[model samples]
Target chain A: MVLKHIRNLKNRFSSIVSRIFRKKRDIRIGLYGPVNSGKTTLANRICMDWLGEEMGSASVVPHETREIQTKEKVQIKSNGKSLTFNLVDTPGIATKIDFEDFLKFGLKKTEAKSRAKEATRGVIEAIKWLDRMDMVLVVLDSTKDPINQVNITILGNLDARNIPLLIVSNKADVRKSSTTKIRNAFPGYDVIGISAKTGQNMKDLYGSLLKKL
Target chain B: MNLKIKFIPYEKMKMDSFSDILRDVKENTIILIDAKLKPEEESEIIEKTMESVSEKFSGIELSSIDFAGEEEMNNFERFKNIIIERIIGKKRGMTIIGPAKIIHKIKKNPKELLLYM
Candidate 1:
């Protein structure tokens, strides 16, 4: 009876010590990419998986996210290990933002100009916030050619800063998706294909994200 | 040189100005204090502008002209005319001024003006 009591006390003490020693620091994970690359969709998927909520609204219009969106303290469980991180969903990054582009999308002149200005500022703000990121997920549309100036510039900046990153080839659910193109373009970075819209191959995404962490 | 000259392409800066006159200078820079602003907000905006500049040029120093004497204003006018005359790639230019330390750097390394945007 005494041995049994001692074993129980020892187990309780070890569990308490383990909890205290566990790494509870909230890692900051930033989602970065160009406009309409499904960044928000992937962010929503991750949020829903862990927090049961969505981060921001996604739309077919370019630069829908005109500001930086953040969701904090998201705990993701993968393969029996749990990781907690603050998710930072940044506005789309673009080299040039012209108001006339929005006119084709059926927006009024005033609204288009305002959106262009806001999106331009958002690009700058996203660049400024790069210094605060612990890890980054560069989302790319698998349907599009991975060879683009925006992708190169973003990756160059990340490489210059030596930030830990993963390339997520999103929208693999589409029949025309070709993640191999992305993998070939960026051979150095880890690329994982997943359908953020339909939650396809999410297990692989979670595992890869944990590896990044 | 009383003015520490730093050249900035207008597209490189990224902030919405609260001042009325400076609003039209979007995608360009004034480099001088030509707009009217409250003294309290003046210092804040000046610092913010300089901070944005520092993000481009790490070691550069920035300064503002509170009251441009006649000669200084005349010099500014001539420089502005020259910029308007031969604008490269139609790129707008703005400059910030400082004292001895900055003047020395500009004089020593003029090529630093063409750093990446």
Candidate 2:
């Protein structure tokens, strides 16, 4: 128990030191979440809104993003305030990956196995990059239940690292989506409901980003 | 197939460096911890699981339920639980971790964890 507190203190100290040193470096805002939670869609929306280009492809299939994709020099202005930062789109994090699951999506056996392997690597990469993020936007599907181990672990790690984050309750355009449920699940955090597909409530997101960073 | 369930105290988990836990998990054992693992510990376990992932061993299904906020506790009970947790440096909860192959899913509710095989 003492060791746990010591580890937490060490994490806080390292977070502070990193923040102090990162002032001169490029700010990296990462999009992270569970599998198929619309992270890449949000990343693409942000890029298209500000840079007039898309960052990455969004797909119905999970783990479409098998590597970390970054778009540099994204500048957004909202309410007369502008901020420029690098947007990093990370592959979805999952605890288990089975090739048979991909087969259910109509993928060939070989392709499914290959994708599963790459996804495992991608999960490792995303975890490793958690320490490098200046801030994170935890994208979650508002239509699904928010109380899960993956969400808890992600939020917990961010809290331990002292990294600023905003819980993005995405898929707000869906009829069954409920941001209130998400807020209830994770209290005491900034949560915004948005639809990347329809460009809904993006201005508020930008304003929040400008204010937070 | 026979199933093995190991009950491990939080202190022994820390002392054993989680190596034993991981090995038992790979050998098809379900692990039940007396306390909810810290977030850092969970992340460390995930990292280790990824490193150990193979064609035979995929990963784990993990879920935890803490008494705080899960049930309607009186203010006094809540306060006592908080104080006890603060003094012990461990949350009053339980964690169940099993190999993903054996445990297909572990659905978490506010008060209980439903394991699917």
Candidate 3:
């Protein structure tokens, strides 16, 4: 009986040591795309689906995300290991450097210029932070033409950096928006058309993300 | 084929103004708009215009062409080739080209077919 008890004790001790010594893996993911392409909506969906609570707000305004928003300590089970994610939502990439445009959004001229400058800095930050991310979700507006400068620029940057990308085409419920056009625009990238509002194709998105992870 | 086209530039009026342009484009014709606005602004405009257009032309089918900036000119051939390779023989529909630079290129090219928007 004493020998059996000692054997159990050894097993418990080794399990504790292994648990203590196990390496922890954390993945950084950036939700990036043009403004109003539903980055916040996608981020909120991810937080809600994975964490059982919404973490971000969706807005119809352009440049709704003025700063970098982060949701940390998100855990996912992949490859039989517990993987943590630091999901970041960044300001949308603008194609032009127009400060006057911000004035239409109700900001004063100086404030608009400052916001534009902040947005420019945010774009640089988003691009530079590409190296730190394990995977990127380049969101696109499905209800419009896919050959956008911002989307192309971001895609080019990701290509240059050799980062794996998953193109999330939002607003799939819009009838005239063609996902096929978007797919054709980006020749050799993994693209998925999903509606963040209706949760269409979100399961597939999750599955694709899991595969990438 | 009946083709309609619309063009909006970055330096011109606000991107939101393009929604009216999209509305003016004939049904079943391609609607193209400049994508050179600030990323967030462009996205917002596109989203709003798309929502309106979809509601107005519920059953009509349309094609759209978004233009990348001048920095992507070298890559233009690839885009044109893709359109030609994917669209030329299979579809004989209307082509709507937008973004000033792309429209300028299209106007210069041999495909000089004109329509109204």
Best by lDDT: 2
lDDT of 1 by residue, A70-165 (tens): 899998888897788899999886534556768899999899877876776677677767656778999999998776545655776677556789
Please give the TM-score that candidate 2 achieves against the real structure. 0.90
i-RMS for every candidate: 16.7, 2.1, 18.4
Better of 1 and 2 by lDDT: 2
Give a tens-digit lDDT track for model 3, residues A116-168: 66665665566545556667999999887776445765776666555678999
Q: Determine which window of 10 residues in candidate 2 chain B has minimal summed lDDT.
A: B66-75
Q: Give TM-scores for every candidate, taking all chains together and pairing residue i with residue i.
A: 0.59, 0.90, 0.56
Q: Candidate 2: DockQ? A: 0.57
Q: Please tell me which model should have the higher lDDT, number 1 or number 3.
A: 1
Cα lDDT of model 2 by residue, A35-57, tens digit: 99999999999999988999888
Which of the CAPRI classes, incorrect, acceptable, medium or high, describes model 2? medium
lDDT of 3 by residue, B1-107 (tens): 44455454433434235455545542433454333223233333333333332212321122223332222446776577558645532222223433221232222
Sort all candidates by DockQ, best to worst: 2, 1, 3
Top TM-score prediction, candidate number: 2
Candidate 1 segments exceeding 4 Å error: A1-25, B1-117
For candidate 1, the docking band is: incorrect
**Chain A TM-score (model 3):** 0.78
How do the residues B41-109 of candidate 1 rate in per-residue lDDT, one tens digit apiece? Answer: 333333333233221221122222222221234667767755753553222222343221222222211
